[model samples]
Target: MMMFRPIFASLFGATLFVATVLPAIAQETLPSWSDGAAKTRILDFVKATTTEGGEGFVAPQDRIAVFDNDGTLWPEQPYYVQLGFILDRVKTLAPQHPEWKTKEPFKSILAGDLKGIARGGEKGIVDLVMSTHAGMTSDQFAKIVTDWFATAKHPKTGKPFDEMGYLPMRELLDYLRDNGFKTYIVSGGGVEFMRPITEKAYGIPPEQVVGSTILTEYAIVGDVPVLRRLPKIDFVDDGPGKPSGINKFIGRKPIFVAGNSDGDAEMLRWVTAAKGPGFAMIVHHTDAEREYAYDRESAFGKLDRALNEAERRNWLVVDMKADWKTIYASEH
Candidate 1:
């Protein structure tokens, strides 16, 4: 019976090893991802690009990464967060713009009639955006957005819009940054609108964000200089416009690009077309239980052409349901 003592001690040590050592071994950069092809491909790409003297080694200065904001980073369904802000702004400033009370798009927005707003299509949506996003000084616009996010919540999730960012993507961003890649947000959403929230949400600073913008003019108000957002369309950073925005803003073709829809197709095309090793990935929203999942025929973040193109080009297609173990950054 005394001979059994050492064996029992060995069994206790093995249990301790299983509890502690196995977990540490499993610790990975993307904790929200299930260890599978999607995660493996991403990690492999990062490793290849980052390894010193490796065939795919990208110089630190040239390690540019561009990401889409709306559906790519956070949730975009049920209208974009920016559009939500505009609808709320229509309500906030309706008392001031009394004519907007009965205005076509503005009236629809104010009444919380999204179906009505959708019927107006591109022209009506543009009208709503211009009215709400323009007229204020750039500083004032920032302040308005900053304040709106304080109280706004996603109608479906009931979580703050800022907290809706995906854990896997956030990990991807940090992981890339850690590997010396400079990340930038290139979205169809308004640049001014995203700059205020991105740093806190994605660790991307305001200067690195590029998006649609209305022209601004220098003015003096009460002896203080200000840049007032004019009521003119400067650029629309969507569809084909994404690549143009990338060239005009980042000035270098990105080595890495991640987007979720057809809107990002051109950007991915341009980035991958560059004459060297590059990676283009699309985040396919597939989790309806954790987040809204719409693609192909969806009005926003339509994934049809992009999905086919990604498959043809052999780009990474991250199926959110299968690839990710957790969706939100706050989730374990």
Candidate 2:
């Protein structure tokens, strides 16, 4: 989830979908958010930070906002959308790798033994990602991800994966941009995988997206220069890595951050704990009907430590069921 590069913007070759998805900038901000303290916090922070001569006033150049992609912007259960991609990919490539029938995670994945797959643990997950995600040129991999997005649907709603962005959050993004905040996505998802669809779905260009990455090298293949993806992780933009990745990519502390899960705990603390005018928000997935609800015990987006820390840090914990007048981008 973080440009990634101009390549993604060029490959996508489309303009922002905000005009159709959200109201004009001059209209009411976050209209899909129900009246509450959560909404008020966002409004108050934005107002205080943008106003001239105010104690919290932040220059437009300094007004940066970073957001986590999975649970924060969309649903993460029954599992992450990227995991769905991984599982499908493992199947698609299985016929070529017959030995996968005996491989630890692959065997379980093919047999639909999620518990067995989990038994393989983090190494198993990394192996799965590297096997399918690397070994191609960056351009080729991006196309593969984009093509998958063209057809991938959420298991629950049967809607296109990219189409499931939360409507209220989308409005919040547009609203922040309208007020001069440069928004970025700092997520654990692969940067290239997300770059293809983020601009169209969230009105955030590829260059503004940051996420986990694998190694890549410049090479000349068939007399043409290309960057080839390698089967080695370069960085992971989650948990403690989120803050470091932000510093390396953006070169400044953001005034606002949004996320859901303990994986984003460090980012939340890093932003809000800054000297002044910083706001951190957690999108509490509490709506079991409009959206699936689980917090402490959820495997996909566990939100325990961050939920407990929100009160002490004064971070806004958005109760999805209570605070969202609408859940999905399509709801608008």
Top candidate (lDDT) = 2
Give the runs in model 2 whose Cα sits over 4 Å from its true position.
1-26
Candidate 1 clashes between residue pairs 3 or more apart in a chain or in different chains: none
lDDT of 1 by residue, 1-332 (tens): 88999999999999999899888866657888898998998899989999999999989999999999999999888778888888888888898898977878877777777788878878987788888888989999999999999899987888897798888889999999999999999999999999999998899999999999999999999999999999888999999999999889989989999999999999998888889888999999888888878899898788999999998999999989999899886665
* Count of backbone collisions in candidate 2: 6
For each of the candidates, give the backbone clash count. 0, 6
* Candidate-wise lDDT, in order: 0.90, 0.92
Error of 2 at 72 (Å): 0.1
Decoy 2 TM-score against native: 0.91
Residue by residue across 289-324, what tens digits does model 2's lDDT show?
A: 889989999888899999999988888999999999
Instruction: Please identify model 1 stretches exceeding 4 Å from their true place.
Output: 1-27
lDDT of 1: 0.90
TM-score of each model, in listed order = 0.92, 0.91
